[model samples]
Target: MKKTFGLLNEEEQELLNQLVEGMTKEQLLWTSGYLAGKSEKDKKTIKKERPDMPNIQVLYGTHSGNSEVISEKLLQSAKNNGLDMKISLMEKFEYRNTPLLQNLIIIVSTHGEGEPPSNAMGFLDFLRDKDTPEMPGLHFAVLGLGDSTYANFSQAGVDFHKALKKLKAQPIMPVRKCDAEFMPEAQKWMDQIINHFSGTSVVLRPEKADIPAGGPVLNGVANAGFTVPSFKRVYDRNNPFYARILKKKLLNGDGSDKEVYHFELSIRDSGFTYQPGDTLSIVGDNPPSLVEAILDKFSFGRDEEVVLDKQMFTLYHALRNYLEITVINPVILDRYNRFAGSKELTDLINDPVQLADYLYGSDVLDLLTDFPAKLNAQELVSVLRKLPPRKYSIASSFDAHPGEAHITVAAVRFEKKERIREGAISTFVVDRVKEGDRIPVFVQNKKKFKMPEDKSIPIIMIGPGTGIAPFRAFIQQRKHDGIKKGTWLFFGDQHEKTDFLYGDEWNKLKAEGYLQKLDLAFSRDQDEKIYVQHRLLQKSEKVWKWLQKGASIYVCGDKKKMATDVHLALLDIVRNEGKMDINTAKQYLNSLASDNRYQKDVY
Candidate 1:
């Protein structure tokens, strides 16, 4: 390590050592690249054409924008390393002509339930087709981003890797599957890929930047947080702004089965500016009761010290704030079974159906109680993953609610196995957090869900339940811009009387003629339990007319059920009313998606 830093002064060397000590392998790699970028900036050297180097085509597919972010990083790193790499979205890539591409690099994310992202669907289909051309001369590498909590984690990456192999394309390296905490792993993967093509290794240099106050300065590189158009002070996961809670109001009335709240957070001095469709990533604490229960089960002292993320903290504090204790995933079970030596747990993990059933509503406490394990504080903490921040759609327009971000959240409480289970972040916001409290937050920008710039372009927003969040922002934005017509919203809930979110606001907007059309579907009130999809079918004529008028459709909600239902309903409308066959209707929808006329932000 000292040999690598022979050029630095004593004080600078000490600082570098401290920084390196706290960083993960992937973070260090990124830090190295960041410093290299700085050095390149200073030298201002003209980049020579790398005609001799292999032509690399980098294609990325993303739903939450993570893959695109990483692809951009990879592209910049490739530039710094003097590599010939061209980046493209998977949707725009010519997958049918894959045999023509000599070198390929894919970074794609899996969407809901093992499905490829919308942008990658067509390309993946091409790969799976029997008549697809063989890419015998192609050399490729794949990196997949996904949440490990899902059963088919990183399935998209797995599919790409297998499909390319089946097409006779040689893999330069094995596919890398990254979990939610994906940046570090993705960076490491990029570095490896860059090194493979470059004639030399990437050189590390001292980073040059001012450390923001209260920021976690690991490896001398600050987290590249959200950026406004000004490009001032980036705030990210490691350096989230502490937004003060401005207001908290219950959206659900009495007699309603749901408990939803509208929260406003003041970002006055945070220098955070976001548009309507961006998300607010909230870093929340685990429920204290669940943390205590786990501590009691281990019979370990709450004061016992445990090291997490290269930092030391009391066992109780770690469980409460740092480690994940709310969800039971295969990763946690696999790690825990090492110390527990429970045959039943191992068997459950091996059987996908049984494992899914057990993990559905179970938490760490449930796992500990069901399979008792005698473990020390370090051992207990080691099995758990870092608590990932939860993202909620920003419910307030930046123009309408200046200096504030808002979210609509529903408390997740359910009865499972005779005990009440609660979501970590959802319950944290609903049950514990209050007005005036400051919580760590960052803006998660969704560029794909951007509102159309054309003022006359109509928007058909289909958002139900808490999914109504971003649409509120959209409506407020339209109001602020003084453009009101051509706005239609289809909102549904359990009942119109009690569960209709923002009912007053919607009515006021309609009365003001700001909302051109409004459709409501209160499922529970009807005998057949009609949802937004059913309403879409019922209004198929008008919906088809709006589509023909070049209306952009936005769907935000549950990925598993609501999104799928609405999609089928839309296909039905296109096929029946447009007088097209099922395949042509499907093509119409696909074309809509390709043209950016259809967008979704589902979870």
Candidate 2:
């Protein structure tokens, strides 16, 4: 009788593996089936020792917390299916482990200007680097979120998809990129990803698993800090303390054609203390006339009770206090058109150009009048974005103007088809609100837009129109601190006499030697438009010398054209005066941006 492999004890089993070296499967089969006479039952036992499900990992990169919400949903789906799943922020995960990942899913969001969100920087660097692993066994899917207004929309997602393909990882599902309003598309993409892994044993039912074991309960106290006896003051958008308006003066001179306002808000006992470069964000109500027009079109009683996000309030209150009714976006049009049931609206919603035309030409109130849609309170709130604060440059320094905040605002008033269109917050601050009227306000911290920490360094400011707001604060701060550095300001507008905002202030600063240089280019004062860029070129020698002496450049204005032109002008100076190639000049400018020497606050 011959010793059989299956019948051997544990010690014999270890010895058999050593005897089987260089033996092929055919040789083993022939030895077992004929020479060894092994039973068929032993062969079936070896086949059972394999993993039940494949290993998978999910990663997310997020900004403003939205991507994390989607990741939670994905994780919950994985949990229900009984799959071995893991989640991590892409930045912290080791890229060297990429070769071991069999199934992977990435959820990411793009920031402004098509840059990857701050959290994704490290992960992106590793993926783009040449040292990354060749992961042929891996399969991946990506979901990207971004805003469409940016020129390079979803560039990070596009790069990730391409990089994964280059590494030979099969796509588990097609990459899905969504805009700011991303719910429906995200849901659809998630469904497709779930379907791809359908054979996995684990299944997640979100509705059943989402709720905790205990019944709904109040978990925390409302207004925790307000419980203190000394915390008597209540500051909120709905109920704001009346701060006396100390000044409401026009900044432009008699001959000046632009209308700019310098406003002072008394913050005495308001508990608001802001630095020189901070922004004061105001929560403003929509113009009353616009609200009334919307109500009339919808035929809803103003007193009708409506609930929004579990809060009960009158329809009028919800519209005026909680919802955005002035700024229009595509998602708003998409949902409203469905509710409107009008042929014109239906066609407009389907046509992208028409939708854009509608958004450009009309506010939300205008849509209500043109195509009335009946909406219950909840339905209305569902379609609207929460009212966000309008940020204004804090034009007064705490050291200079104690107990008060100042802002320079260009009141936006226009006529569309002979109908007046008022800017919601600008008009509220400038025209409607009275002295002693309370305005809900908060500070928006600006880290990037700030004056040089070392006051002795020279500074150049280019601000036109109402873009002069932050520069005013900068000047006020420099004056208070008695900074001896050279301060050059390049101010421009429509005309010299009437449109020259803060003319007296700039004149005084110049006379006091606080302003080393005050260059003005009133476009309409001359026959040809003499803008800021032309003035920059006019003083290129001095500007180039200042740059050599380590002066930090700052620009605050319209981003669409003026900012671009000003940037180009700086590049021209680098190329012509600094004698650098175009590429080198660009690199120099980028270096300035990264080092915080170049700063911009443009809308």
* Global lDDT of model 2: 0.72
Worst 10 residues of 2 by lDDT: 209-218
What does candidate 2's lDDT look like per residue over 524-545, in tens digits?
Answer: 8768988999999989999999
What is candidate 1's lDDT per residue for 1-603, written digit by digit as tens? 333356887778888789899798899999999988776422113232335334888899887788888888888877888877888898887665455567889999998788887889889888888877666778999999988898999999999999999988999999999988777677678878888989554733222222232222211122234232234455677657667688999998889999999999888877788888899998777887888877776688998998875677889888887778889799889999999999998889999999998989889888888998888899989998878889999999999989999999999999987878889889877876677666678888876787898978999999999999999999999999988799999999998989989999999999998888999999889688989999999999999999999999999999889999999999999999999999999999999987889999898
Q: Which numbered prediction scores highest in TM-score against the true structure?
A: 1
Give the top-scoring candidate (lDDT): 1
Candidate 2 Cα misplacement greater than 4 A, ranges: 1-244, 253-258, 268-271, 341-355, 369-377
Assess the local accuracy of residue 568 in candidate 2 as a C-alpha lDDT between 0 and 100. Answer: 97
For residue 510, give model 1's deviation from the true position in Å: 0.3
TM-score of every candidate: 0.84, 0.67
Off by over 4 Å in 1: 1-54, 199-232
User: Model 1: how far is 268 from its true place, Å?
Assistant: 2.7
